[model samples]
Target: MKRILLTGCAGFIGSNFVKTIASEQTDYEFDIIDALTYAGRKETIQEELNKHSFLQFHHLDIRDSSKIEKLFQERKYEGVIHFAAESHVDNSIKNPNIFVETNVLGTLNLLNASLKLFKENEAFRFVHVSTDEVYGQLTDDEPAFTEENQIKPSSPYSASKASSDLLVQSYYETFGLPTMITRCSNNYGPYQFPEKLIPVMIFKAQAKEKLPVYGDGKNIRDWIYVDDHNKGVWDVFLKGLAGEVYNLGGDSERRNIEVVNIILEHLGRSKELISYVTDRPGHDWRYAMDFSKARKELGWSPTVKFEEGIKKTIDWYLENKTWIEMVKGNNK
Candidate 1:
């Protein structure tokens, strides 16, 4: 059985990926290491915990070098899908040092551990999950960011993520450590933290509170459904060549206002609640991914339509109000 170590297994994306992997692969041994940050909750992994015999949990922080070293010393993970990091842009803006510590240095800690572990096993691969925000903003006519786009991170969050990407590349160059990266666009689905745009808007709209729109809400982002993003990760992890970077996107480009309006429409809510707020500092104007390389090389594309996905997302938020409340810190 292939042993897989997945970091940040309690976060929105990581937990979803774990559920998908556990359900699909019943024979593989999966070890999850998570710090259980504010955004990561044990409730997110409940279904997988109850259902999968091959799944095991460890409450370990990636920044703790001894803990990470011990984890590598004990298990021979055939592959690693690293998803752990401080991911909120607002939070990063408030405190940039934590972002640097966790994102840049923490990533290096994992990479170093992987380097030591790989000495015993030569064929393992490390898949580093990243975001498209690392490319900063785009002009109206500029082509979508392909692998060749220059890195121009604007925020502490994107800067930190970009820093980690550089470290991942350095490992590949200096030690020839097998590593691959996937820079995915914004992801939304079940179990998302309420701080994000989609879930926050859903909550505020449901309560008739202000649906805050940063700036004019014209900023564009390529939003991919979380399940589709998971499939993209698995595809690149299993089939992608080492030291390569793949950009994963849903090809669903929607402006901020358009996305909010769609959410309101799905919830049977009004647009009167829409409120314009101050734009974030160094906020990227737009982010679009060029996934042709991924399509041609990995033979992968998103299966969900944007409208259908949005409807499903709205329905999920409605049906899983209990989960939403828990994530909001109101249930506890």
Candidate 2:
């Protein structure tokens, strides 16, 4: 069996990936590692953990180099799909050091370990998951950010991700290590942490609490479902050319206000609950993705539209209040 390592998988998109994609790969054995931070909750995947014979969970902080190396030596992983990071821009603003330590240094450790394995196996692959924010904000008239866009990150989170992306590329160029980077737009789906925009709106709107809208709420984001993004990631891992970068987009661009309004309308909440809050520093005005390369190269495009995906997401959060409470309680 082919053994693979998936880092930071107890969180949102990674958890969904484990549930849907990894579970379907019966020939592949997966070793999932997560720091189990406030956002990464093991409970989200407790059902799969109980029944999936091909899956293993490791309570690991990728920042610990020695421990990471030891695990790498033990597992002798043939592939790595790195999803670990301090992803929340707000949290990154509060403390940038952790983002650097975890996103940059932690990825560096993984690259070092994977290099040894790649040399031994000659077929090892390292796929780094990244965000479109690294390309910075886009204007209304500008063409969507493509794989060819230059890096110009505004927030600390995106900056750290860009740093990791560059480091991965350097390894491939210098050491001939097999690596691919997949940059995707915003993701929304079930099991998303309440701190994110979609979940935040859903939770607050249900409670009749004030819905915080940053700035004038016109900032736009291309919203890909987590499933679509993960599928594109898997395609890149399996079929994409080494040293290549791919962009995955949902093809659904919605303004921040539109997203909030959708949730409010769905929940039958009044617009009076909407509260305009001070925007965070370095908040990118807009983000759009042109994923033509991924489509042409891997035959991958998003299957879930925003409107349909949002309804499914909302229904899930409402149906799984127990899971929600469990995840929220851990953050305290």
Candidate 3:
């Protein structure tokens, strides 16, 4: 069986990947590592750990180079699906240093280890999962972002991720570490942390509390189901050419306010609950993706439409209130 290392598998997108892609790829043994940060709880993935012998969870921070190196030496991973990073933009503004540490330096450490391990196996693959924010925002008339877009990160979080993306490219260029980068649009579905837009709105609307919408709530974001994004990542890892970058998008774009209104309407809550907050510093105006390359190359396209996906998301959050409290309690 092929041994693979998946970073941040306890978190939202990664956890969905663990429950879906990693679960189905039975021929591979996945060693998942997470720092157990506020967003990543061991409890989130405990069921999968119990169910699958091919899966193992390690409690270790990617920021710790020595530990990462030791783990690399022991496992000699044939492939790496790197999904760990401090992804919250508001939190990144509060503390950019940790974002650099975890997203940039931590990625360097993984690249270093992957380089060494590559000598043993000629086909070692490293897939860097990234975001569309690295291309910055778009004006209303602008076409959707594609692989040709220039790197113009607007937030510290995106800057850090862009830095790591360049590092992966460098390794592929200088030392010939076989790597591919997959930049995806905003993802939502089950297991998303409450701090994000969708869950936050759901929680507030459910509690009959005021929903905080940033600025005018007109900022646009392309939404992809976590499952679709994970499947695209797997496709890029398995079939993408080395040193290439792929864009995976849901093709579903919605305004922030529209999303909030949808949640409120679904919960049978009043729209007056919406409280417009000051715009976040460096908030991107709009984000859209062009995933035609992924569709053409990997035969992959999003299956779940936003209307259906959002309903699923709201229902999941409603049904799994216990999980919401459990994940939040870990942070406290």
Give the number of the best model, judged by lDDT. 2
lDDT of 1 at 325: 68
Give TM per candidate. 0.98, 0.99, 0.99
Tens digits of per-residue lDDT, candidate 2, 117-226, equal 99899989999999999999998779999888899999999999999999999999999999999999999999998999999999999999999999999999999999
**Each candidate's root-mean-square deviation in Å?**
1.2, 1.0, 0.9
lDDT per residue as tens, model 1, 1-332: 98989999889999999887656885678899888888889788978888887888898888898888888888878889999999999999999999998899889989989998788888889999999999989976789999989888999999999999999999999998999999999998988888999999988888889899999999999999999999999999889998999999999999999999998887788999999999988889999999999999999999888889988988899899888767778442
TM-score of 3: 0.99
The residue pairs in collision within model 2 are: none
Give the Å error, residue 21, model 2: 0.7
Worst 10 residues of 1 by lDDT: 323-332
Model 2: per-residue Cα lDDT at residue 308: 96
lDDT at 192 for candidate 3? 88
Residues 102-185, candidate 3, lDDT per residue (tens digit)?
999999999998999999899899999999999999987799999999999999999999999999999999999999999999
lDDT of 1: 0.90
